[model samples]
Target: METMRLSSSFTKYSSLSSYSSFSSSSSALLQTKSKNFISLKSVFPANSIPNGNRNLTIVSASKADDGPQQQQHSPFWGGESFFRSVLASMESVYLNKNPTAKAILERVHSVDNNQICYDHLAFRTFGVNGHGIGSMANFFLDFGYTQREELRFPEKKLKALWFSPPSLPVSDGGSGVNGPLPRIFISELLVDQMSPQAQEIIRKCTEISGSGNKHAALASALGSLTWEKPLYSEFQQLARESEYAAWTLVNGYAVNHVTISTHHLKSQLGNIKSVNQFIEESGFKLNSEGGVLKVSPDGMLLQSSTVADSVSFCFSDGITESVPCSYIEFAERLILPQFKNLPEKEVREFHRRDGFEVGSADKIFESTSKEQLTRRA
Candidate 1:
């Protein structure tokens, strides 16, 4: 096995040839959260792993700042190693697809000493052929994430659910290093609700591609499209009916957006308003659908996002055109009314407003809409 070191406390080790071959023997590790190092182990049954040249990279985050530290933290459901690997892969692919987001993240890191923490990760899918939230939810649920609230966008013909991640160990004395993990927000378009023509187009593509649930967990991380590229005509027809459907057609399970937890920033850019201003001043266009700053009805959650970056895509017919890809979002979860009396230093993850707001999220989805794209153009 070969080991590769990544920035921060992450380390990657490659061994297996397929994600399916990766299984856990215990859930002990998922319950153990440490402030030091996390141990990772792989026990492959004889010949269970394929002989291919493919590499299954297992990544784990170590908390030691001095040098590489090794401590046993059981490996179950692939443990944190598998979880971190998935997150790292998604981020890598997302950054590669969105240059505007990449540059802004770099700037934010330079100012915050790379203390960046993700607020949540979003994904889009078709609510047909068993490829919706249920397919992706298992991957997180196996590793200690619990399903939260279900949000609906009736006007947009979409429904979504957000999952809360396992709480990290507070043994670090609330240093804010290994804070709460990012939540997962997954939304799916109601394919049956689309026009007959649009429905046929989607059904044809899904049938040709087959159900992608076999390894749906790795789809986003590997940046692989589960379905064949759609014809430009089909894409256009779907777009006329629902832009969300069109976007998901080409993007597949790839990340829709990764939000920056502005409150987690250790610098002056630690609020949504300041972060939005910073991004706009940095030459990136903000999604102006409902306004640059979207505040929750209760005013406890504030959010904003960059317009989706347009990337050149070659259609199934060999015609290529620029289409919206992914975007970056910024969010600030204000301290809950009950926790407002707590001292600043004592505030923790639970002290702030949690989950998501439908009204704010409804507008945030426009980050990839044509209206927002036209503003970018």
Candidate 2:
């Protein structure tokens, strides 16, 4: 299967592989809000990560004398060992549902000297204290990621926060090191904002999961459901109001989708239109709410995604029906003409857009809605 073959553009930009080599010479003190609760501190030296034009660094904030405040370097999270585990875990689940992605991964590795490029990974959660966005963010924050931006969708009763990964120093100049790390978008359904019946059902699911020692489960934001399954009637009711909440109740805090940056694929597939055409021609249906492409106001960012796959789940009543599971997304960010002439560093920080567009994301969230899935079916 000669699926989308990532050009050297993606192969050369994998900074996730760089955290392996750390020097003992330079190290920074690191601490988390609750070191005892979440063991996030690790002692590793600063090393370069490969991201075509992006670099991810993990450090502790420190005050400097003459120059700007320097990022006191800390140990990389999980290092290479943990890095491989994380990718493997995510790939296992993502590939299971998205054969399209599996084909692409196999194709890339078949040629050797290549790896897939991930524009971003998104997770859906309930808007609860220790179990929602705050808890999910901790997982990434432990790995040196910091919150960058927040977005809201009152109509959908949802709120999202985007996190940026650590970056390498300017002295460690390399291709694409100027760009930021692959984003991690975490959104939580406003359960309290839902109808009383909906809220009670969600609360019950959380209660079931919290019955035992949940402290250990807080470390990870992905995996199989920790709560009891809902009755078909309850699930339908929740889905009727907010599919996102119903998804979390059944699927728990798992990845909703992984985004691919079409801009990076330009060398291989060209523009967003080309990418969408290729996927559609390959037999995948795209989200049509805002059309196949959702362009930002300034026309700098464009987005699209495949309709969620119909995954069947058995209700407590012993009935199974297929509903939306997960999907793949594509994003293309245009460089401002003004910044196009500037150096790559300036362009990365000032020109290329970061974060999500409210209207675009609002529709993207519908990928898993019953209406979208039924229409595609």
Candidate 3:
């Protein structure tokens, strides 16, 4: 529950996952965000992380004159972990292309790799309890090309690698708790020398010969590689297809993360407005309306309204047995609808007559996605 996990938050939820046909978009978004989070794994010496092309690594900041301030307020917190995740991911991509030619490399090939990546993070999520994030996001940081590329490594010459999150907060009063350790870690082993067949495959894959230009693809694929979590494109496609209304998409990459983190912000998400209003839950936002809000169907009181609050009621005219919150935790939960349908105009008229302002003639269920995006620009 975004509101509960963060306690202090929630954002708007425009619709439900099953509002339309069930789509794979939710899974895609989960996977994509997980991929971005894994991007921050770093091999740099001691607490350093990359910010874009610069060595904005944590070590450099720590070495800076800030002293205790830096120690007390380490950069890795909440969603800002996305930045760290991005750095980790970049290193992974770099390794993907420059696999020590002869130094050997490792790989991951299926659900098997999932376990390895999980080991790297040492983090576990049992369900989609946070917004839609939970267990699906448990191993995001060690996934992607690092684990995936292991499948493409030179046969017989494969490397054995294991990793875990170096970022977990230090335990309070542990056995000889050492100095702050990294959340980025990877253990490696070299396999037999590259096979001639494997070498040839690499040559073919990296070929720059006439009619075979793979460098461009490689460059495009690896360029600006990051671990920062992202909203998957499949999620977008699904949202478009779902009956759920939306407000706007968030572009967390551009924001000053040291102040506000993408993950921290995203943590505020709820299934939809009706579930709960947790802002940082999903980075989703509305116009001037406190970003987004969800009101209980029975919670509304037409009799309690005046021509004053500039509010109105639009009834779906169905009995809604909605669960308290639809965060992934309650996956098996269902709500039975029990009401009659009414025309949009009649619902609007009743609401206006009650006392609230009806949105424009075009908007339905009071969604302001267009307005929010337009104003965001």
Candidate 4:
């Protein structure tokens, strides 16, 4: 086994209180009118049709074997093309709502003209009335993504799964103009495990305005809350039991966080620690719950995220309050031991650590927690 190591200087700096806190009141919410239903026509523009039949290879690491395996997929069609639009819309919605993320992307662009590559796009949902991972997974599954391992967070009453994307050539089906496509990480609150009172609050909201399986993905792509505006009291009640539930109550099916793959950055920012330092130096605060750098027990996967921004939400009672909104995340998947001997140029997505870590992700989930959100204030 390879020894886990990180820069001593980076570790020391990460432990210090160097980030500046911003007043949440100064941040304005990018509010949109609630839509009863999001039409597919709105998501799929006329020009968004498939240009050509493109064959792609899907890669998956076999748990029963040492080396990675590849499977040939059929020619690309409307699914892959439509997924691109979905991603574009989700990113647009996220950037429009998250100024902090927009500024960070601008900074990256200023440094290098290269487009940012995503590690994964995360979504949070409630597990009730056909509104959980199954609703969201179908969209990605239709796009040639494969379901991977399941991760559970007993303490948070949450369960999540990460999906691997079909690897296509740069011009064909990757995330941006270059690099590999990002994985999808969707987590749902374990509603049944919550207190009866909290469960009732969630049940009422979903029952009143839940988007059935048919339109769940559309609602997510539009970044629309499928449910009616939640009451402040209900939000508080859920927050006391499970902060995850409270977050989903207001920001239903919205992109929870878009993770930047630091290793793919191929620059000084490629190092996870260096990227965290740059983010803090650039004036954004990171989630410091388990320190800025969250590492897996084996240390191959390292992650960090900005403290979630505050959004001005109008409650059901017509009272507006600043609540936690989505934020940005950074991840660095280190090269596996077997791949360490290979030339740097030969390393591919499979060469590095894949999937997610429960321990690291558990902390990453706290990006939107009140404790982390308080840092923004």
Candidate 5:
């Protein structure tokens, strides 16, 4: 929400025309002639999480009707210790791959306690119960996070949910810090929906994973992958049919990416555009699936991300090869026209758009797809 002044040079280079054009037929169908026109109603609902597959127990502190909600959630949902633990785990891997992020952290931490905070942490998981989306959600659900929105991508055969971390008033909510906290976006690959061959490859990976002690296999859901890696040939075959399944099977329960909230970071990095320019100039590649900048149809949310970093993946053949891991994202949210008069700080808290855009997210997912990876290779 903070205003950012762009230097003349960066401003000149940051035009929307500079980004690539999207070719997906779905995107073409959704595009409007006017730059500002976006179909919001079709893209995002007030707060709709698909009812059938979700088991949302965490309730927000702001909701007034505490009747049924009071009975459903845990009293020990979040605390400082648990919050730190999760960030520590994510930072370990994120920092290693993103030098720009690492430098930003160092630069900020040297001055005050205002180090970079994540806008969201994304995880890739299977559709199964204990070792799938449910398992990852349990970790946050137990800490007072409530599911906010469910996004379904039939084209990609993916279903994802975004959970809002608890607010301060929630007695057992996140980190004891009151304010905008990062969301947890967990997506599952609908393996059963894939072809028989793709399904079998994923099934084999999961079966091999579950063959161990039940507790251990369950633990691997959000932990480092424990199953033996699939052969590169198997990976390639699955990649041809469903990249989501192939990525999940290889990097089970891995953190897909860490997002940086531009609204929160504008005071430091100028804006999301500036952040993207800085990262690119610093030698990181931005995902060009949709474009370097993915603006919502309504233009409320603007997002861009670095392509996934190549990390070592040991295959069934016992050879370790570099494959996609994770990357950093920058998001700039605009104040809704209805609340444009509010103060910048207040606008961020009160009006900045929250929740993921299906179109933008669909393209964001390509950050790790075989197409992008193959291009990088």
Candidate 6:
């Protein structure tokens, strides 16, 4: 609902003419698109501006609504949370017609809270990270739709949803720490869906990154994210083959690996059949199953069924690591806790490891075997 402005997005070093002449086929690697328009008969029926022929619309929040309505949402917001509803409003309509959004990712060599906030906004589509698409976990699971633009009923749309944890909180006045030193969670989605080749490239990136080889994976991914083809049927056929992974998470708000594994993440990994293969191939040694990742009184991943295993992800260099099963078991028993043998209860209760040092490798890996095992993942 703000005034539209021209954006000087980052472009290739080559001339604009060169980019324009680039091929539009993503069968192999390569890429390069908006959300607006409103119609009850259309996809994004909320906050879309009217354009007669094209599926591009920009509807103001005020105009999108018909009458004065009471806003009913959680007041748990700490002035940092963003809550945009795609109700039968206009904004949702626009994004629906053009689900594609431009993504820009950076190493974030340093802390930038403002940038982190902006990045969260940018992830309105695509996702917060490779974890999965971003959405209000509970709400969208109840009302979200997917791939309907390409697939038919009882298939694309479902009771699935996504989640994005809160941005890193500021721990002020302790050990001389200040703003944005250890909090960043921004995602940059491409303006177009990646081609099959691009998907393969990302897969390779995941593999290479997992293996601790990132530079090559980054180059490969950047060069292969094109979506210029018009093979809807072909893509649909591939989709029918199905190859993705799905893991479970407990809560959407907590960043703890135990609580962050939302259902959306599970489906995004690999499809149903491929997931089965991956599980068997990877020899998934779940800490606790039956869909729980909590810890027990005995200090294990399970405790009288009160604890369960949940999964999440974090990528560095090029590998996107899927932290599966009970994070408690992984972080405490398998992975190092980065302390002088301090217990997790003490670590958490005292709010120690307040900087970028806690998530360091020394804290994440236990032994040579564990490190090697993680790399193979």
Q: Give all candidates' CA lDDT scores.
A: 0.69, 0.57, 0.20, 0.67, 0.57, 0.21
Tens-digit lDDT string for candidate 5 (292-351): 899887787889987776667779798777766666677887765656776665543335
Q: List the residue pairs that clash in candidate 5.
A: 38-297, 38-298, 77-143
Worst 10-residue lDDT window, candidate 3: 324-333
Worst 10 residues of 1 by lDDT: 40-49
Runs in model 3 lying further than 4 Å from the true structure: 1-136, 140-287, 291-368
Q: For all candidates, what are the clash counts?
A: 0, 15, 58, 0, 3, 43
lDDT of 6 by residue, 1-377 (tens): 11111111212111111223232222232110001111322211111212222111111122212221212111112111111212222123222222211001011112111222110111111211232332212122111111111101122111111122222334331110112111112111231244555345334433433322212112111222111222333323323332111111111112211111111122332122332233334443322232223232223111111112222333223333333222211112111233337553443211211111111212221211222224422
lDDT of 6 at 88: 25
Overall local distance difference test of candidate 3: 0.20
Q: Tens digits of per-residue lDDT for model 4 on 291-372? A: 8898777778888999988889999999898988899899888887776898889776766777677777889899998888
State every prediction's TM-score relative to the real structure.
0.81, 0.72, 0.18, 0.80, 0.72, 0.19
- The runs of at least 3 residues in candidate 6 whose Cα sits more than 4 Å from the true structure, single-residue gaps closed, are 1-338, 349-377
What lDDT does candidate 5 reach at residue 273?
82
Q: Give the TM-score of candidate 1.
A: 0.81
Better of 1 and 2 by TM-score: 1
- Report residue 376 deviation for candidate 4 (angstroms): 6.8
Ranked candidates, highest TM-score first = 1, 4, 2, 5, 6, 3
Predicted structure with the largest lDDT when compared to the true one: 1
Model 2 lDDT vs. the true structure?
0.57
